[model samples]
Every structure is written in C-alpha cells, then in structure tokens.
Target: MSFNESVLGKEYLKYCNLKEIALNTKTLDLSNISWFFPTCLLPLGIFIKEHKEIHVIPPIDIEVAKYFNIIMKDKIDSVKRSYIPIVEILPNKKLIEKNLDSLISNKDYNMGSLNAFAYFIGELITNIYEHSKFSTAYIIAQRYNQKNFTEIGIIDNGISIPGSYEIKGFNFSDIKALEEAIQGLSTKYNDNEYSERGYGLRTSLNLLTEGFEAKCLIVSRGVGLIANKNNRFFYKMKEKDIFNGTLISTRFDNNIREVNVYAYIDT
Candidate 1:
C-alpha cells in the first residue's frame, strides 16, 4: 500500500538481507512484513516457488507458499494465487497461450484495448523464454479483492538487461541497458506487429505510468528504475545487492475508469 522509492529502497534492502539469510538457512518468509511495493514480493516468490528443498510459509496477501502452476483463470481463488510457473509453459505452450489470452480481466479494460494488456504480458514472457537463457523464471500476482487494485510481477534467474544487450552484440552498462529498454531499444532483430523489438517492456512501462497513472518498477542486475505517474528515475543499487536478474512489477486499478493503451503503444 505504501509504495514509493523510499519505501521500495527499504524493501530492496530487506530483500538483499533475506538473500544472505537464504544461503545459510534455506528458509525464506516475508508473509508477516507489510509490503512497501508489491514488486518487492517477486524475488522471494520466484526463488522459493521452484526449489522444494527450501522451507516456506504461506502468506495471506500473496500465496508465496503454494507451488506455482499455469493458471487457466484470472481470479485469485482460495485454491491458489494467480501465477504461471516458468517450467509449465514449455510442454503445453499452445494450451497456455489460449488460457493467457482469456485470463485478462475482460471487464476491466476498454474493448478497444482489451487485448493490449494480454499482448504485453505474452510478449514479456516470450522475451524471457527466447532470450533470457533462464534456468528459472516466474510470474506472480496479487489482487486486493477489497480494493480496486491488482499487482503482477515477473522475474527470472537469467542474464540481466545488460547481459541481454551483450548477447545481441550490443555492449551497454547496466544503467544504459535499462535506459535503452525504456526507450524501446530492443535487442531482437524481429519486430512485432505493433512496434519494433522492444515494444513489450517499454510499452508496458508507458501503460502503467502514463496510461494508468500508476508506478512501475524495473530492476535489472544491480540497477533499478522507478517510473511513476509524472516522473521516472534510476536507482543505482549497491554492489552487495541481491538478485541479479530483471524484476518487473506494476499494478492496475480498475477504478481508474479511463486508460488509453493505444496512446502509449503505437499501433
């Protein structure tokens, strides 16, 4: 609920601390601590959701305790939180795509741009699979049934943003990679129907910050970028920071009433 740079910075520090503790105990839990930013929950969720050897406790807010599986439905039912385990996508990709296509809130978005949200989500997932060279990847989400708010997070244990750029023969510092990504500079040679290679992340960032008037956070390697409704800036993390892979998290408020996805995504 209290999500901002100051609060997120503290949570990031907490994430780093927990990462160190994870090495020793192999036990991670953050259910009790109220979140500063919903994205802060992703790193822990992605790591423990896969490794069964790691002991964990379920949280009421987000079901970090449950083993993640591809959700054919969007609602966060009592059975499980909305999530798609990275491993679940490969063997059943066709079926998973069908489910994801229907998973977005059909009622929340305007009909004209309804598919845009799903397209963005699918594009990011596709990028991770085709590019990340990830041993582990995950998508975790939380919805406050009481409020008009929902948050989704995607993360991976693959090459960070700079590494992705390097893989494409583009050498950039971590910050530069992130900056270019926000500027819609993709490492892919192929282009999507709507835009060039980098449409997914850049467009999503615009949709969240510009369209929805909300905040979006992207952390890659040790660098973090915080994009808010009016302003965007980068936060350089300390060398000892934990979690090297890219982390992206954002929220959608159904109460916003008007969101122009096309305004941000060039068709």
Candidate 2:
C-alpha cells in the first residue's frame, strides 16, 4: 500500500493494513508514496523494525527517502536496534528526564533551547500516558547540523483525541477535538483548578513556537495542525482515515537561544 498523508487515519484499519502487508510480504514497497507525514513515517519505522524479515523499498520521493534514511540510519546499516527502546507503558518521569538530558548533552547547540526542547519532549510523551488508552508509544529523534534543526517524533496507537473526549461525555468531531486541544481545553472537568487538566499540547506548542521559534505538526484522527512562531493552521485529511491515536512532530532551530523553559512548563 502507498502510504501518504491522505491515508492517515484514527481507526485501527490503517495500522492493520500496514501490519497485514508487513506480515504477508518479505519486502514492503513504499515507492508509490510521494508525500508523507512523520505520524505515519515514524510508526511505520517502528513496525518494520519489529518485523525483522521485512525490507522497506525506498520512497519515490527523494526528500521522503532522505528523511527515512536520516532517522533510521543506525538501523539501515545494522540489524541491531540502536534507537531507544519502545516504551510499552508509562515510563518513569525521572528516567525520561535522564534520557532527555543525555540526548541534549550530545547536541552542540544552545543550552537554553535544548533545555526547552527537552521539556517539550517530556510533556508530549507524558500526554500519551495520561490521555491515551494505548499500551505502546514510539519516539524517534535526530539532530541535523547541516539543516540547523533538531526534529523529534512521538507516535501512539490508541484512542484518538476525540475518542478520549467522547468517553468523557463531550460530543465533538476530530477537528473540534484538535481545536480544543490546541486552545488548552480538557475533557476532564476541573471546576476549581484549571491546572488539574488540559495543559499538555498548548504548553508544548508554546515552548516550541514561542520559546524557540520552532515548528510543530500534530495529526490525530482526520485533522492535522501545523504551528510555527508566526502562525498556526489546520487541514483535513482527504480520505477520512482514522489514525487510532496521535502523532506529533516538532522541529526546533539550532540557532535559537534564551528560552525560558521553566516558565513555559510552569504556566
């Protein structure tokens, strides 16, 4: 199957289709996909790695092929799993912090921006544990000195944003759920203290766009959002494929500095 942004969905069907293809075939071809999203790209990498026999045919799109090569470079040359282990359950916050610290330390970039990026990563991952019903989550990160940017991808196969809110008794469409999420609204009713709910996505976006002048792309269900320092916009997928959960990809400029990580996380 040719994977593209249009085939991205929030139901189990899309994932199932990929899994079926992987299981039945020794070599999975991706040459047909001209354009792609990290939401699908990251999880597809994880899925392929899990199934050792499956070989991926490079995408026809040169840029897409380059991205896959960069993110999975360690895997491309070796059979060993070099990337961080997939977290099947909520990981300990301290462990995550330690990992982030190590990840940041390896980068020769602005300390303040790195710190903010670390915080943003922590929050985004934490959201998966707090909000989703899924058991597994995948993260992939790469720093491109030539491109002068650092990219991080987090993905999960679970109940989507709208599905989670619906379970909490709020009826809304996928786009509405995404809109509310970016606005810092939560399905959890907290009359006395707003802090008790709904700060993950908004605060993470603030740190990325406002704090570091970064760019973020979030895809869930049938809606996708892209935000940067100057503006934020949303687009609907053409096929209405349910994605079962969420995928967030962020890119932070290596040149950014003077970020107030504490303030963003606290507020």
Residue 217 miss distance in model 2 (angstroms):
0.4
Number of clashes found in candidate 2: 8
Q: 1-267 in candidate 1: lDDT tens per residue?
A: 222344345555676776667657887664565443345555765556555677754444553324222222233223433322222233234655654544565454476445555666777787777667776555655555566676667777788888888887877878888898878887877444323757677878877777666657777886887777877788666776745787777766656555556677745
Would you give me the overall lDDT of model 2?
A: 0.64
TM-score of each: 0.75, 0.70
Residue 46 displacement in candidate 2 (angstroms): 4.8
TM-score of 2: 0.70
Query: What's every prediction's RMSD, in angstroms?
Result: 5.1, 6.4
